[model samples]
Target: MGTPVLFIHGLWLHASSWEPWVTRFQDEGYDAQAVGWPGDHDTVEESRRDPEAIADHGIDDVVEHVAGVIRGLPELPILVGHSFGGMIAQRLLGQDCARAAIAIDAAQIKGVLPLPLSALRATLPVFKNPANKHRAVSLTAEQFRFAFGNAVSEEESDQLFERWTIPAPGRPLFEAAAANFNPHSPAKVNTANQARGPLLLIASGKDHTVPETVTRATLKQYRHSEAVTDLETFPDRGHSLTIDSGWAEVADTCLKWLRGQSL
Candidate 1:
């Protein structure tokens, strides 16, 4: 049987966003599927039409939801996640849920130090509003441009925002922000677990939401683990690296890395 690959989408994106990558992986002989965030809309248009459908959910909800999907799979899949999904991947890995995992511009997990100014600015819309803790939040085109399309052109940024952006639950953002302070925070990951398997943290050099320093911090925290944890940088890329025109490059890089690991 072919190796399994599970794709997890980040905030504001549906599983459909990974369609191209799924196709690419299938052609390369991997059994791949894109799993949605719990309560996520079935389509981007549906999400745009009624963003409230995905409201009020938090990090723990998503982490367990995806873990259930992975547990039912025939084999321990190679997990790939973006943004918040990346955090979920790491969480799953912490529990030894996958054979290997890749986190692309992953949202900050507990222990990732010194949150960058760009990440704070990128998340201001949600964090600034206390009410957002229980609500979903949408980004304006300008905000999306600043956060996800900074490395792309103005025209391209507008187009990308129009096509891909959607409202996202703000609860996870709140939980992640308060994780370090709360010992029982759901945002925590078991980075010290040797059984967590191999991990690759991919950072977008130009990403405003998950800067290189953030990924570097995560890499440092994972260094004590017996499992292999490595970092890779894709310069000139933004947080939208997985959905941008150069997405194939990211996919190919992942494929190459997986092959090297014999996964």
Candidate 2:
């Protein structure tokens, strides 16, 4: 049988964001599981009303949560994550918790350079208000469109906003911004480990949060895994690549890459 796949989602999104990809992977003979971030609600609307439930969740908490889930699996799963979820996946890999990992539009870990303007713009809202650091905040339709669905059509973007966007924990964002400067920050993942299994970094060309340059720059830190490191780029995809119109293509590409690995 093919290896089990564990999916982790980014901030403001639930595990349901991976439903389509889970189906695709299952069809390819893989067992797939989608895990929610700590305090993630069952629905976007529900999460919107009780945003506080997700407000205090931090990087360390999320990493421990995902690790707990991984411990229950029969074998090490192929880990797939997006944005903040990608950051957590890297932490899991550094802890020797996964068989392989694919980070799509991943957030910046320690030692990654070249922060993009788009990333700053996307994060400006969180930094604008100090209270946002301890509170969860939901985006308006226009805000979500600009930050996440810019590459998709108006109708599709609207639909996606209605279905997926939620009040995300601001603490993680605050922590991520300050990670490089903080010596004791848990937001930093160890990428120098040579035995962390195969790591693939996928960057979306149109992604505003994690641009191509930033993603490529982050890969350079894994010098220990020179032969195992891989990078792939998908043009015309924004930050919401997994839930966008052409998500199947992205999932298919990831499935193929995972299939080629030793796991």
lDDT, residue 117, model 1:
94
lDDT of 1 by residue, 1-263 (tens): 58889999888777887999999999999999999877777788888787777899998899888888878889889999999999999988888889999999999899877788999999999999899988889999899988998998888888888887778999999998998999988879899998777899999999999998888888888877878897889989999899888999999999999888888
Superposition TM-score, candidate 1 onto the true structure: 0.97
Model 1, runs deviating above 4 Å = none
Candidate-wise lDDT, in order: 0.89, 0.85
Residue 192 local lDDT, model 2: 76
Q: Give TM-scores for every candidate, taking all chains together and pairing residue i with residue i.
A: 0.97, 0.96
> Which pairs, if any, clash in model 1?
none
The RMSD of every model to the true structure, in order and in angstroms, is: 1.1, 1.3
List, residue by residue over 1-263, the lDDT tens digit for candidate 2: 56789999998677888999888888888889799888888776777788778887888999999989888888998899999988888889888899888999998887786888888888777878988989887777877777788899878988998888888888898888888899888777777787778888999899888888878888888876644778989988898898998888888888788768845
Q: In model 1, what is the error at residue 40, expressed in angstroms?
A: 1.0
